[model samples]
Target chain A: MLPAAALLLVFLTYPLGLGVWLGFTDARIGRPGIFIGIENYEYLWSDAVFWLSVFNTLLYTISASILKFALGLWLALILNQNLPFKSFFRAIVLLPWVVPTVLSAIAFWWIYDSQFSILSWALQQMGLIDHRINFLGDPENARASVIAANVWRGIPFVAITLLAGLQTIPQSLYEAATLDGASRWQLFRYVTLPLLTPIIAITMTFSVLFTFTDFQLIYVLTRGGPVNATHLMATLSFQRGISGGQLGEGAAIAVAMIPFLLAAILFSYFGLQRRKWQQGGGD
Target chain B: MASVAIDEVYKSFGAVEILHGVSVNIEDGEFVTLVGPSGCGKSTLLRMIAGLEKISRGQIAIGERVVNNVAPKERDVAMVFQNYALYPHMTVAENMAFSLMLKGVSKPESDAGVRRAAEILGLVPLLARYPRQLSGGQRQRVAMGRAIVRDPAVFLFDEPLSNLDAKLRVQMRAEIKELHQRLKTTTVYVTHDQIEAMTMADKIVVMHDGIVEQIGPPLELYDRPNNLFVASFIGSPAMNLLRGEIATGGSPSFRGAGGISVPLASALSIPNGEPVVLGIRPEHLRLSDDQGIPVIVAVVEPTGSEVQLIGRTAGGEEIVANFRERHSFTPGETIRLTAEPSLIHLFHGETGQRFQTRTDQ
Candidate 1:
């Protein structure tokens, strides 16, 4: 136990301490040894770009998380039914999560490109758009595109999680509903949805964290591009620390994200606890 | 009041038939129990009546309408399942009121229905509790309350008490009988327990291998079983069977394994050396001083009410007899026993069909 504790202290605690120290110091590219207290934090407070990045990150996280949850639940419900080739369809649904993220992002990039993208080509062909539209060139469209990409990737995880929960429910419950003369919607509303709440809450919490810290897909597709409209906290940290060589400012920005992430985790914790209490108190 | 009639119903899954062509006329306010062992299609037959399973062929009618394809909701039937099938999320009140609410009954009307059913089932205190919060018996009461609230044409029970412990099973069995007596709703119950069938059924349908063996009142079945299956299945500790041959003679004595003889009335006509199986209830065996067969007791089990003796005949065949008092005997004790001639049942060994005794006729 002592040896494992020592290892944890070295590998985890030391790095956290170093990151905190770096957040307060002016650890830039050329002036690496400077230690200026609170300046980096003050700069972050007044930074409009940082605030916009924060807003964009929250928007992407909330939208993508909600979209993934809805789509995943619908897909799970459909797949739970007695259908042909159910196992084959389930395997196909998992492909999005299993593929390499970089490859998927690159493929999506080509599909959303302004001139020769397949989606633009299909839209033009369908006469939905008057001309070939650049999906990622416009700021609003780019943010929406990145969110859609995140949703597409995360949907399989949520669906599989919810499917496992759905399978645990006994078939006798549905039969009981039929005997009670429950309509199709009532069975889902009273039986399926109430039973699935715990699983959905857990999966959505994980999805929020994954969407908030997402870097690879956005980097490969947009690079926080189209006038920095799609930049999340992770992307901005990467640009400041690695690209612009402002390591201290980047560290401060990264550290500023901690309070929001903690707030999210606490919110989820209280929500889950309240539900558990409600269920337990009834008994 | 409603009468349920099943006419020539057959059910099949893929190519394997689970229920053969079957028909039953259940009169209004009668409790009919379908009793059989596992894989006997009794539950399947009950589910067909409840409209839970599709009838592959023939017709079923609840009253005047032929309801071969009517949905369960439209058929006005409520079922109490073996596992109770109470919605885990809903309180007992909500579970009882769910069907009424679905039919767009007013809130007060539904609440009244729920309250009345709860009061009848003695479940008013449990109305606010969910299924997981209730005990097994409480859950069963809630299930019954749910059925009663619907006030449907017929009440169906699919082995609803099978999940309870032994003592609770007995208590609940009586409660169910009392409930039926008060409601007098046409009920079709399914179970694997013959005791339940005997105690609660107005008419018992005995099924075996997806075929009906016999349908009659409990005492009618006990006194006159149509076949070997019904004969052995309807009684507890089962009827003791001894194979012997009946010959044309004056006394018509039966021969046993070790050349032991037992007296029989000359009512049955049998060819010389025709093989037959004789069945006797354990309670019918007597310890007599007259000419009797001697047997070595193999095991003795004594309950306060009766003493059961497992013994082997001189022919090395095992037989069991129950005595009211403790016989106070060790294993291997030799005792002479005889069966009442009128109580003995004879069956053709080949066909497993009973030969009616004079009193039976």
Candidate 2:
């Protein structure tokens, strides 16, 4: 306990207080100014580009989270089936998640290039389009491309966790459902989905939180490019704090993501409690 | 009301066969029990009848319909599992009404069906409660209630009461038997305990090694077993077997290894000097004068109603005697044991098959 407390004070509490304090001052790269309360937050409130960055973060989080859930659940269901070479397939499914995020994001960067991309080359060979597809040129296209990269790297984590959840359900319930005259669809709706709700709640919360504050894939792929169209709060914060050298504003932007994360966690916590109450589960 | 017939059904997994060509004919409203030890394929046979398992060969018919290719949902049979398998998310009413709802039953109609089954099982208060909220015995009743609401043609029970405690098991056993009598559903049950089979089954099929050892009424199997396996398996305290040979001389008698001779009350078709195994139930061995086989009492167990004595005969065969009259014979004391000649059973030594004995009528 002493060691843990000492580590928390030295590493976590001190830095958190310092960052919050820095958000209130006009601290630049080489100079520390007097404490100016609410000045950075006031400027951020009216800045159109700052609001756009918030919008971009919301769009990225919602789209990527929904896609990750749908595809991850599909992969989990397929992995749950009785097939030959099942363990081998499951191990291979986790490759993207196990590899370094920046390394894999580099691969996605090459694939989403405006010219000479393998995807564009394959599409040209199929005659789907006359010109080389500009994957990351337009603002909307860059936003979409970054979200697709995020989903690709995020799917394996969701799939593996949900797969562990699926294996915990007993086979007898399925047999009982089969004998109870439940069709394939009804069996999933009544048995699998309700039983899987808790795990889905947890997995989606983590997915949403990570996508909301994501930095690495966006930094490596777009770098808030195409006129700052896909600059999430995390990337914009990094741009101001480190590259632009406005430490105070960058800390303020980073601090702004807390309320949304709290909302997501509380929503999931209440949803989990409702499930427990409905199932008469233990406290 | 429907009869079930399993005609020479066999099941195999890859290269090893688990159930041999098994057959049984269950009449309408008959409570038949398939009883055996673990790994004897009794549960496998029950699953095959429910269409949960596919038969490798032969046919299973439920009321004239050969359901070999039917799915479990299409077969219209309900099963009570060993673990209950109640859906944890649904209330008791919903768990019971789920099948009817899937059959496109109306809300009021399905509610009425669930209420009727709840009444039959006395689960009215628990209709709004989930499975995890109920006790073991209550959960057991809910599992039966789920099956009852289905109103299927046949009900299958796979060791449904083995999960309960001893007192609860006996109580639930009686409850299941009573439920069968009140509903009169043609039930096929499986259990490893012979007492459950003997007390509850209208007909019992004893299985071992994936094959049917014997099938008969409870008392019939108890009184006249065709082989050594059936003779030993059906009774609570198993029958004692002694290796001996039957003499076909003028005064016919069976002689044991220690040269202890007990005369036969009847004549046998077996030739002289043919090796035979003698079987005698414990209750049949009477306590008499010193004119019978000599033995030393090893232990005495008094169950308030009867004195069960375990003794060793002079030829070194352990014999159990359940005597109605209490005798205060200490251990290492000498005692004489005898049996009425009619109570003795003789089987072929090598074949383990019982031979019929002729008695003067």
Candidate 3:
């Protein structure tokens, strides 16, 4: 017990205490200064660019999470079918998620680039646009592209989670539904969807958290570019502290995410509690 | 409500055949039970009738229409699974109303149907509860209600009472039989429990491996089983089989394993020296001190209502006799037990087929 307590103090408490201290003081990578009293937080509140980054993070997180969930459920259902070589198809479907995110993000960056991009080349060929489309160069398209990338990278996790839930459901339930004259759509609506709600909810919570704090994919793909259209709080924090030399303001901006994170945690708890009451209380 | 006719149907999975060419005529409003041990193709045959599995060959007609290619939803049949596959998400009322809703019945009519079925099953109080909230017996009732509300042409049950406790199984068995009597719907029930078949079935089809061993009324099969399998499978303690060869002379007899001669009915056409197996039910064996084959009493078991005596012949083969009261014999005591000649069954050893007896008395 003594050794475990010492390790926790050395590893967990030390890092958390250091971060909180840095949040208050104007501490940079190579230089440090005395603690500032709420000065950085004041700047964090007044900065329109910082607030825009927050909004972008929420927008990207919500859209990507919902799209991923829907596509994941669809993929799970398809994979669950009694098709030939089902495991092989399921493995192939997991390729996007299994590949390293940074590499896939870089690949997507090339595909969405202004010139010599396959997407632009195809659009030009199709005559949807007569000229090459500069997808990442525009703010709207950049945000959408980033959200799409996140969704692609995250969908397999959701699908695999819900697939496990689906597998636990007895095939007899569907047989009973068939005997009740339920159509294919009715079976999914009344049987599959209700049974999968808990799995989907848990997956959504994790997806929201991961997407909200997303950093690597955005950094590799857009670098929070196109007038900060694709910028998230994580990327903006990095830019403010490491690039703009506003270490105190960046720490304040990073700390500002605490309230939103806490709110998400509370929401997830309440949702799970409600689900518990609806399904059955406790184990 | 409808008759189901299975005509020479066969089913196989990949390279393994599970059901052989089998045929049975199920009359409308008849409660027929397909009974056999596990993996005897009973459930598979039921599923084929329900349009859940395609027949490898042959035809199944429900209510005069060949439903060989009909989808399960279009078959107009309701099935109650062994596990009582009630939807966990829906209330009992919703579960019962689901089939009517699918048929596009108006909400009020469907609700009334659900309520009527629930009331009949004594589940009106549980209509608002989800399946998980109900007990096993209650869930089973809900499953039956779900089927009842549909009022399909036929009710198919795939060992629906197997998951219940012994007491509950007996209770549900009577309930199901009564339900069948009240509804007067054609039903095909599948179970491995012989007691269930004997009690509930208007006709019982006993299957073994992948073939139908016999099909008849419960008493008909019990009193006159066509083959050794049916004889062994139909009874609770199971018929005792003793192997021997046919003996010739003034009084023809069956020579058991230890050269003990047991008299057979003279009407039986048993060739001399041909190997034959003799079958006798336990209840038919009487223990008396009369002139009969000597048996060594090996064990005695007394239930509250009856006593069961386990004995061995001088040749060291075992046989059982169920008595009406506690037996006064010790384990080592030698007793003489008589096998009534009329109750003895003779089967051809090579083919395991029962040889019909011709009596002119």
The top-ranked prediction according to lDDT is: 2
Fnat, model by model in order, equals: 0.50, 0.62, 0.59
Better model by lDDT: candidate 1 vs candidate 2? 2
Q: What TM-score does each of the candidates earn?
A: 0.95, 0.96, 0.95
- CAPRI quality of model 2: medium
Share of native interface contacts present in candidate 1: 0.50
Q: TM-score of the second chain in each model?
A: 0.97, 0.96, 0.97
Report DockQ per prediction, comma-separated.
0.48, 0.55, 0.55
lDDT, candidate 2, equals 0.90
Q: Is candidate 2 or candidate 3 better by TM-score?
A: 2
Worst 10 residues of 1 chain A by lDDT: A274-283
Count of clashes, each model: 0, 0, 0
For every candidate, how close is chain A to the native chain A in TM-score?
Answer: 0.93, 0.96, 0.92
RMSD of 2: 2.1
10 residues in a row with least lDDT, candidate 2 chain B: B352-361
For residues B1-361, could you state the per-residue lDDT of candidate 1 as single tens digits? 6999888889998999988888888999999999999999999988888777999998999988788888877888889999898887778898999888888999999999999999999999988887877889899999999999999889999999899999999999999999999999999999999999999999999999878889999999987887788989998878878888886677787887888888887756777688888888888899876677788889999998999999988888778899997778789779888888888888888898888889886
Query: Looking at model 2 chain A, which ten-residue stretch has the lowest summed lDDT?
Result: A274-283
